[model samples]
Target: MTVDVRLITESEYPDWLRAVHTGFLQPPVASDEEARSRRPYTDLARTRGAFEDGRCVATFRSFAQQITVVGGAALPADAITNVTVTPTHRRRGLLSRMMAADLAAAKERGDALATLIAAEYPIYGRYGFGPAAGVAEWTVDVPRTGLDRRWSRPESGRIDLVDGANVRKLGPDLHDRFRAVQPGAVGRDERWWATRTGAEQLPDHPWTEPFYAVYRSPAGEIDGLLVYTADDKWGDAKQPLNTATVLSLIAVSPAAERALWHYLCSVDWITTVKTGRRGPDDLLPLLLPDPRAARITLQADFLWVRLLDVVRALEARTYEAAGTLVLDVRDADGLSAGRYRLDATPAGATCAPTTESPDVTLDVRELGALYLGDASAVRLAALDRITEETTGAVARTEALFRTAVRPWCPDVF
Candidate 1:
């Protein structure tokens, strides 16, 4: 059967939405309200669909984004999301076609890189994407945290239970401050806050009214925000056994993080707290008196990145020490393949194409993994994913690329 893969028109949006839901194993129906709610934010030019026999069988979309690199430099990124392929359309190269088109356009538009939250582990590597960051979720046994039962207020800041309206008003600016210092972080749009705060609602996925709490410093400045929901549970004898699950938590300061966590563990009848996805090396576990009280519930790769412009991506972030290296980046798709010389110093960095002998050779996907500074070149070399042509090149790469703290992308998208 012949399939047509191209950008969807504005008139085909409802059908596209249905295709998306169907591909994702949702209700397989898109209501008019759902289309209308999402249409304003949808860019038709960047949204593509694979149609066969007048039915959309696959869907893909990308949007403008800014990703924070090492040293807090935000680079232009093409953030891919809402990608789905119906089971019937699998193994037909539908995704490859859509990805090639989108990436070509992104490179033409001068986007430094492309990013996505991989739903599966083994799919995107063939498309020049690599796991760039990891996420961790902890389930804390509150009673074992060894905190005082009478603990209510923090020593430095105070936590206030605010409403969603207040979060919509204060969230954007606070997130900006937090993202500025966070590597691997991505910028959020206005619609993100609106939908998250329930200013606008989605039909297919209904929004629950979650409790919003904001942490204020002693000087009266908002520095942290926490959203959580509690489940009501009881034993056979009517003993309370509740779990407070954090939906989202953003803090710009360590004090704010400590205070919010302390407040959660101290809530009456709250026997457990599920800390949401956090940085792999997050302070959540260490904040507790007994670090072992916070049990690891989930640890997995979260963010994947694909480099489009090797020079721009390599030069956008800072290095740990002064060094020069010739890197031979191999890209099977030839989107970002070249031998480049990178001269990095304490002040800045410069990368450009060169004919010099390579000190190290690797694929563009591996470079994407190393770009955020969380990945270790030595480990990749040990795994045979990287080839060190010169003596001690792998160690040099490790010293230059690894950050003190692991890179974490807080938002899934």
Candidate 2:
């Protein structure tokens, strides 16, 4: 029997979701409540499935999103997720077909790029995606931090424990303020907040109530929010050996960040704190009095980007310095291929197809890496991933593309 790939009907969602779970090695089940909860947020036309013998065997979906670029401009993105193929149907071109259709639709829709969090590093590159941002995690030994255990309140702000309702009320506005200035950050929708705060729970995923802490500046403005859970353990002699794990921490200011870390370190009975995935160069370690007290647990690439429109993607970001260069962007899929001239300035940039000779020649995947100002063109050139057609073009590319602070995407998509 031949397999068919096409956009799934609303009636086929459950089968599609079950196929997703099966591909991910999870229980292949979707409850009615779960289906109801997800349907409202899903755009059915963008959800495609591969069917064999009247059953879904592969799944892929994309949604509307906005990602902040180098100078804090949010570009419309086609955010992909829930991609999978059954083991029985491996290497059958299902993923490629689904991806091609989606990318074509995205280009027609005028999205600047497509974004995803690659579960495996090697999978997305062949699809023209590249690692754009990285994440870091650390485990802190509270006893070695050398902080006052008797610390009570923040020096310049106050920390207050609030409930999920309060977080739902304040988080969206605060996140808007944070993502506006933070490169590589993506927008979060109402469903994300609702699911995180227990407004709606998906089936087969257990939820634990976490403690929420909000930091207010001296003027009483909310600038930070911390969500954490604790494991209760006791030593043989009745000493507390609890460890607090941070689920999410959002801070808009340095003072708010410092105050939250201070509060976590001083909490009674909490001997260890696990900082969840953060930006590779997060301030958590430096915030501690003894920086060595925090040991890195994870350092890996997090967000992956694939440029759909080369010209628009280049013009969407602001350059760090003034320079003009031509890029020979090679896309094997023939979606976004051509030599383009980019005239960049600190103020803004303009990119368009031109007949000018190339100064730097690179694949579209490499441009995705450089788009958010995270990856260095000079380093990629050294790796032979990029060619500098003109002397000093790589340096100019490096200077124009690199941001003072590395790009960091807090959400996984």
The lDDT, on a scale of 0 to 1, for candidate 2 is: 0.92
- Give candidate 1's error at residue 270 in angstroms: 0.8
Expressed as tens digits, the lDDT of each residue in 176-289 for candidate 2 is 998988898999988889888887777666788899999999999999999999999999999999999999998999999989999999999999999998988899899888
Q: Which stretches of candidate 2 lie over 4 Å from their true place?
A: none
Summarize candidate 1's per-residue lDDT along 1-413 as a digit string, tens digits. Answer: 79999999988899999988888788898989889888988899899999999889999999999999988889999999999999988999999999999999999999999999999999999989989999999999998998875899999979999998899889999999999888989998888998888888887667889999899999999999999999999989988899999999989999999999998888888999999999999999889889999999999999999999999988888988889989999999999999999998756799999999999999999998998888999999999999999999999998888888788998976
Query: Which regions of candidate 1 deviate over 4 angstroms?
Result: none
CA lDDT, every model vs. true structure: 0.92, 0.92
Per-residue error for 30 in candidate 2, Å, reads 2.1
Q: In model 2, what is the error at residue 10, expressed in angstroms? A: 1.7
Worst 10 residues of 2 by lDDT: 198-207
Model 2: lDDT of residue 313: 87
